[model samples]
Target: MSLIPSESMRPHQENVIGSTQLQFDQGSQPRLRVVTHTAKSILVRFGIVGLARQWPSSQRQATILRYHSVSSAGDYRSPTISVHPEMFRRQMEFLSRHYDVLTLDELVSGLETGSLPPKAVAITFDDGYKDNATEALPILARYNLPATFFVTSDAVLGKSAFWTGWLHRAVSSASEETLRKASDSLIGGMSSVLSREKIYAALASQVDHAHGSKRQQRFLALSRAFHHMPPLSSPSDFMMDIDDLRALLSAGMTIGAHTATHKVLAGLPEDDAREELSRSKQELEQALVTPIVHFAYPNGHVASNVDDAAIRLTREAGYRSGGTSRRGAALVGTPTHNLPRQGINDALGFSGFVFKLEEARFSLLLRGS
Candidate 1:
């Protein structure tokens, strides 16, 4: 099932690996994406995947997997933020059996000590969904793996849905005509063929930076404008309550702050960004009775979601580490305040998931990490 090349092919193989790494690290143009995926497939076929996984340097690099919701809500859920319970269980089982699963604390400690185990991996969940408690916990417990849960204090405490969750529910339940109208209103026009993604993008663009009461006001206006749709479900249905977080803590998982209302800090004024970072840590510490040492920038995947000011403020607020949505495996000397994590979702099936773990590793290895 793996390619075994002769000695004559070694130089050519190195060339292939180098070129693929260059294309992957560059921008994701559609053509480059196709080429990169094809290159990955070719590498996997050539048994480079096995080499990447078993490479000794992999022991020195740690992969942190980021997740949002582990749920069975199916079509009622947003796939961008969820993995079905069964898929999640399988992924965890694979990690338990094949990977060296570490707690976030342990990963940080390893980075500090410059010694990480081979195949080191850490699991983390963001946005504090109720399913992280009711559904994801038992499976993780079954595998005896510890993960970090970065929670938005306001959503959990107020029992309100995260803005993305609210938008998902609205988009999921909206009729085509309603989507058309909302799209037209929000974006100043619309395509003839509307979609949930199109609508969600429109709404997210409108409110991703709105914070506090202003955020509520915008969402309320959206709801009022689309009043014909059925009322959205209770926030408890989407978000974890205080009890759920306590349950996570009781099960020996770590809690980290993800801002108070999940506002993108890089876009906010200095005072507002400070409040989002500091207040979340303070409130969650008070609520959970544990020092919140880690912070994940909301929408941290986007370059715009993180800035020098955001990183400076996170450190000034006393967070020991800050995780970003950036893709790559973290190695020793990777900055404590800007750890890059790969976002795992349902779209990456088990094979894709396995490949992702090594894809970045292969790139790093080629570049001599």
Candidate 2:
């Protein structure tokens, strides 16, 4: 009567049947009752399991992969944020095996019209790190993949107002105790167990204020108090120089502006915001000899801390599109003003990367349906 067999019955159905027959001989009526109940229970369990397995709820989604740098261990504080060149090659190889990789422009066009292909992915890099030229470009070329690099123009040209350089040095040079004291000094009696990761997040939250002259000066002073160590013998030792940018341009990668001094656009006055956006765009175009059409916010979050004026400024500055670190696939009809991209860290291995791509695609399918 039952559809599912017990574990004991799994190996030999004939043996279970033979044993039940033998038990029945000793007590006919009771044996019949037991068999009836057992069979009915198995039938119900089997039916439920079959129905659950047959139901359609295990499909995957699509997502884009965004990276910051692919560099040597010496250059990066977080290995997850910076994929090694070999790992980068492997990741791309895995992607090529399973998905259709799209260029930035193709993905943007598809998103504008709502016509993305199945299992499509786009790759992006941020910050224009020098190692991007030294490490990432060769690997990308091997796979014939095109990527967009968002450059903070002042940083690319070796200027010092960008907070990342100071932040990196602070994180690299300070002992755990010194970093703790610095955090306490800035935020006033905060806990001491804060890691560099947490400190970076806290500092990023306040970087929007760097657009204001007074606030910017205040932050610079605070950084000096906390992070300024003996200046590196050469400032260009840490960042990509102008010649490095030229090498990137020559390699067929597109460069997008990430603001002049990497200040959060929304936190600055309208005039200052305009200057950051316009000047960065103009500088990059002049350096690269091409129209720089895309932009990314310095910290990439505009929800709570950044103001709408920044977005307005970018549009007015003539950028064709901008990106944010929101986890979603680029879709047709997605606003050019607030395109969402997935921020990838090293923790996302080949399997994790594949799964995220599926997740983004699945969301798009659901939207279409």
Candidate 3:
């Protein structure tokens, strides 16, 4: 009953074929990538994004890039989520310089009509972080890239920090050494694991599996599980308010629903899932005075958050489109509610940034974490 797409049930052949070709292309370069560190990237650079250019017709590469928070590197920053303003600026500039920035509607139209321009991309942000309005928007406007924000209605309307924000703050309080040990202890002991990304993913998986205080307890326990760092409690640790969302709409940005409380729909019972979708869409429309047509799976990964049931609920709620956080090429032929996105983070650096924009390993290496 899971809403996430399965391998055998993958919705689109064109999307899969392009994804496979890129994986095969990148498959032979592990040693070369390890040796030069820059060799594969050099190919991506000179090849004019060989991933997109090499794709056959009916499989045009239209990547949907996913981001979470953008700020000046304080409480709002997460190891997996936040991107610095400078880096964001550079990224936007790079995208504008090389590619055509498309709106969600534009991407869908291209997908439906097969008229997608080469080097096409769409930008999106998750969690409705306030900094997205304050810090990220100015830069986005400066570059004039059309973007979409999928927000959790409860967080914004109630002005509360997301449960995960507290967890990140707790982990951030400890040194990397402490986090590694804690995760090893809690998550079945992996020797090579260092960062908290996998542990965080594990913690997030537990979120929607239970409800009410059980959920709160899980978050708080995870918050305290690390080196006992206090949770980051600043007001900045929340989604954009109504004013912020409306302003973005006024600025010509699109908005999407991320559920009522950012719950993982796959774990919820049918009625709960239905409420999360329909209610959040209603709330967004009422607040922003615009129809909410798109939805992003809370975690958007097959194993963690989404499943086929979630997809069915999404359609039940009447969203025009939905997507997963899994890394891969954004293909037009895929199911409208199951597009794949490449995750963007600071770790990718400018070259990694370029490679991601290149969508080089999208199907091979996309991670929601």
Sorted by TM-score, highest first, which candidate order results?
A: 1, 3, 2
Clashes per model (N, Cα, C within 3 A): 0, 17, 10
Q: RMSD, model 1, all Cα superposed?
A: 4.5
Higher-TM-score candidate among 1 and 2? 1
The TM-score of predicted model 3 comes to: 0.76
Displacement of residue 5 (Cα, Å) in model 1 is 13
Q: Which segments of candidate 1 are over 4 A away from where they belong? A: 1-47, 74-77, 209-217, 228-236, 366-369
TM-score of 1: 0.86
Tens-digit lDDT string for candidate 1 (267-310): 68899999989999998898888899998998899988898999
2 against 3, candidate with superior TM-score:
3
**Model 3 lDDT tens row, 1-369:** 321223543323222222222212222211112212264456455663454443343146588899988876654347678788899999999888878789988997888787888768899999888889998899999988899999888777764556666565555566766666666665666625545555565755666576768877766656566535434233334567888988898889999989887788886779988999999999889877899999999878555577888888898789988978987666657687888887888777777777666653333222110
Tens-place lDDT per residue, model 2, 201-294, is 5665555554456666656655565554643222435456788777766777778888887776765678888888899899888877888898
**Candidate 1 minimal-lDDT segment of 10 residues:** 26-35
Computed on alpha carbons, the lDDT of every model, listed in order, comes to 0.78, 0.62, 0.71
Total colliding residue pairs, candidate 2:
17
At residue 246, candidate 2 shows an lDDT of 76
